[model samples]
Target: MYYQVVKRLFCIAALTCSGMYAQAQHTAVKEPKDVPAEWSKAYAPFRMAGDLYYVGTADLAVYLITTKAGNILINTGLAGSLPMIKRNIEALGFKFKDTKILLTMQAHYDHMGAMAAIQKMTGAKFMVDEKEEDVVKSGGATDYAIGGGVSTYQPVKIDRLLHNGDTIHLGDMNLVMLHHPGHTQGSCSFLFDTRDSSRSYRVLLANMPTIVTEKHFHEVHEYPGIAKDYAYTLQSLSGLQFDVWAAAHASQFDLAEKHHPGDAYNPAVFKDRAGFDKELAELKAKYEQKMAEEE
Candidate 1:
């Protein structure tokens, strides 16, 4: 009886320790090294522009951009993160009526999870790629490319279907759309040029890389053609000049590293055109080599 009692106590202790560990992980923040601790709240917020705010969620980030032309937003995180996003925007002293265009790169639920709600709330125009419109309307699934793998995502509609090389203007911003299809059939990106106080214009590239997640979050399978398209997509994009590159999960790489006081990664790592070319060449070489071996 004493042996059984001791065993029971040990089991209970083990379970308790495990529970604590799990809870800690659940609340942990997964962001670049520069992310501040205060940004670890359930729905932490960041400022991107004078009147624009951003919020980071588990797998996505939402931006609230306001302009004289109208209010524009980019990327809405997960469905559950909407309330916090709304609250964050409200705290910035703007009502939902102020939002105009609700633009997203793709139809991944995390990127567009709050689209329906935001559209309903602000009556904003949600724009997406024409190829992505069907997928969204059909409520189909997509393979988000992340690194070499893919993850699943739910479908959603794009109120305004966009095409490659199309320019959409908002206030003083002229955003050019680029169709980057390695991540999804309709995976696209946005580009815009901003003039600094020095009167020099710089381009901003908001890339939507193919996203892949672990099995726990894997909700869809990859499309067979995604790998082929990703290579072509990146190569085609190399010609564009962008001073900054931002994405959903990661921020502008340069900004992220710069923001981290002690981070080893430097934005200079990607600054060299030759070095960037070499990396791309190597990636394509590896892919070709693997394909050759299979053949």
Candidate 2:
């Protein structure tokens, strides 16, 4: 009986130590040394649609959706992105502290690096797609594709777990969360409606599923379903209908060509259906080619 009791105690102790060790690793993490210049380069913020505004860098894209209750911030760019975001928000006459909810496009270190800091400062509830909860909480340390026990950002706590087709309610906004995994397990997109003085518009903040890992899905033993996930994301995003669309990166949607720094608040500037469709087709073609290579 004593031996059995000791065995059980040993198992409990092992579990406790494991959990503590994981927490320590997460706490000790910092971003990689090789920082991209464009990730932090300043960009002029502008209104994309009625309530949605651009508040990110020249390459990395972050968006703010204003509401009467508060505001919903989506996709805090790489680490150290808070100061820039703050400046952009202030430039647009919005308070950073007024952010009530935080969101993300993907769980990559670049996209989620500032989430923890922002959440701590604003006391905003951080919500993520159900599949991304673990990765976000772990600060990208637990990501299947790129995680190597060395984390890239401070871990964030999830206030709510979102699922596909979930409607996020914030004041007068009803942003629908679309789970478009494969970039990471829970990489997602947002779809919603907002209006200007002239007309209403449907806006899609699409999280494009650009493959970032090695060429072979079989190589990623951590995520056995990665191949299927990528296929699903590409197929799903292609059929989505929207009046205006933007992506996680400015170049992805051709921001410079569409809007200038001092341009007017014309939502029509983003109504490039042909551009979005062409990009989607090109991405789809690349995926098919990758699949062929895999075979």
Candidate 3:
């Protein structure tokens, strides 16, 4: 059964790779139409909790975590928003030169589109799970390139390969990596301590699975037994020692009003002990129930 699940996930990853890239390649040929209100030319970046920043986009969330050495970026915004991401980062009282690490939550086009651009701009090393390195280096697995509106991205060299339970260090910040396989074989979350003086931990889950149509799932190659695995991953992550949460997409669990900006109410409030326990319980029940339904 485990092998079946793993095989299913691998196949799905390949299909999603193709589908993702096709969209990016096509989308890159045209000027983005119908930009969102938050992404409007004059919109400003709002603060979330800690050092994380959300410039506002349905596709990707731009996070900046402050380390004693330098700030770390969680994920780059979508392909069409690279310039804005750069501008927003600059507006936040920091320069790209201060960015030391660029972490990809997963290899999906939307999450990684601006990776190459950000790396060039900031000279930060890129990190992804070793399992997905081949998929990423081969021009991406999900077939999409979210690397800013830029047509081409130099393949990102992996400076570090994160494994489950491995904690990544950035001066004062310690980001623990969790390899949750259901979203993508290599999908991961950067779990770390918040900047609060009290020093609580927080998790930035990358792309939480949405129960879109099966075609949508198949396009991304939803794995066969992954429904159960994803549930388990959530259950495991819920046990970790963090009280803050963020993701590449800002849509889950209402971490804040409008957006998760540092200046906004600290999203860490959701990561508190009570909230974390509640969220994990709810997520476990939700996904477990969904898996039974599929059975």
Q: List the residue pairs that clash in candidate 2.
A: none
lDDT of 2 at 192: 98
Candidate 3, superposed: residue stretches over 4 Å from native: 1-43, 55-59, 141-154, 197-207, 215-225, 255-294
- Alpha carbon lDDT of each predicted model: 0.58, 0.88, 0.62
RMSD of each: 14.4, 4.3, 11.1
lDDT of each residue in 209-242, candidate 2, tens digit only: 8875464888888888987988898889888899
Tens-digit lDDT track for model 1 on 1-295?
Answer: 9999999999999999999755533332221234334233354455442333455553365666566778778877665566777777777677757788887776665566566667767878878777677555533332333322222233343567889998877787677888887556887777765543333333444453433323222233545565566666767766767554455554323334333333442333323445445545655576555445545
Estimated TM-score for each candidate? 0.64, 0.90, 0.69
Task: Count backbone overlaps in model 1.
Answer: 7
Model 1 lDDT-worst window of ten: 145-154
| Residue-by-residue lDDT tens digits, candidate 3, 158-259 | 788888878778887787787876666677777665655545545555445433233322234435546555766776665555555655565454544444
True lDDT of residue 183, candidate 1: 56
- Model 3 has an lDDT value of 0.62
Which run of 10 residues does model 3 get worst, by summed lDDT? 142-151
1 or 3, greater by TM-score:
3
Model 3, residue 113: C-alpha shift (Å): 0.9
Give the range of the ten consecutive residues with the poorest summed lDDT in model 2.
Answer: 21-30
